[model samples]
Target: MDKFKKIDVEQLNIVDENGTVRLKLFNNQNIPPAIIDGEDILPGHRQSDPIAGMMFYNTEGDETGGLIYGSKKDEDGNYTTSGSLTFDQYKQDQVVQMEHNEENGKKNYGFSIYDRPNTNLREDIIKDKEIRDSKKSENEKIQELNKLWEGNVRRAFMGKNGDGDVIVQLSDSKGEPRIRMVVDQYDTPRMEFLDGEGNVLYKLPPEE
Candidate 1:
């Protein structure tokens, strides 16, 4: 075996004994699409999608989750960068995630957790991705995707915001944040209850 102090490569793939792709590392110029359970995710790309990242596969070659990062600068000096670490629930959706993002000087960092129904999230995502790719009006696409999320996965979000505020939020089956508790930058704490349409119904410790 040859030993080297360091290795530089354009791309790398780690496969399992059964020749299944367990992990992959690649340069930003050549990024691969998402694959789960040996099934490829629909649509090769999204609007300014991440350019580089590493993906992980489960025992059955299903994509459990990944960590990805991307950045871009345009001629007009506008720029955006983002990174995310995620973990998918078995047979469901991404139940945990940590993410950081910056765009045109605006920066944010947060993490979240979700609860999904029994449906296979991998399939649901693929189907939704394909449906999203259909050549329909932008408004139509949004409406269609919303249909898929109603009463599906999505449950809660608990994290800190860019403003240094920590929050715990609960959602309804339709993926609406119905409740939220927050500790602000100055450590001021408050809680809110909202209706399904996002109208605030009440607040704990009424405002001064």
Candidate 2:
């Protein structure tokens, strides 16, 4: 085995015996595009900003999930930082994730579990892009996109919000929060149950 005191590299790939890329480590400029079912789909899905991170691939080379983090200070001296570690659900999107996001001096961090449809996420993304590029009006596009992405639901989240409250929220299938337990910034603890329409039905302590 060869050893080096230090190695400088922008990107690296770890492959299996059959030469399939099982994992990839990369810099912002070297990050690979999203790969699904052996096809490279939306290249611009990550948006215009550059992020450095690593990607995880399954046995068939499909991207399952990965960890990514980036921080930047703008010309106006404002700071933005974000990081996430996620695990995908088969051919779908993230089923579980831990994330942190901060901008200026505000911060939010949480762990979440999502419920996604069995449909192919790659296909949905491509169709969404097509709809956005078509001649449809904004309302029509929004309606179609809403129907298309309705199956993606966040089922649970436990995190500290930007307001400094620590919260554990659970939602229904339609992504409506049904229960919330929180510790406010002032150290007040409260638990509430809500109806489907988000009206608080009950609280731990009876109000005056």
| Best prediction by TM-score | 2
lDDT of 1 by residue, 19-113 (tens): 87788777776676655556666446532475678877777877777888988899999999999888987755578888888888777777777
Mind giving the per-residue lDDT tens digits that candidate 2 earns over 72-171? 8979999999999999998888999999999998999999999999889789888999999999999999999999999799999999999999999999
Residue pairs with clashing backbones, model 2:
none
Question: What shift in Å separates residue 56 of candidate 1 from its native position after superposition?
Answer: 0.2
- The candidate that wins on lDDT is 2
Tell me the lDDT of candidate 1.
0.78
Point out where model 2 deviates above 4 Å: 129-144
How much lDDT does each candidate structure score?
A: 0.78, 0.92
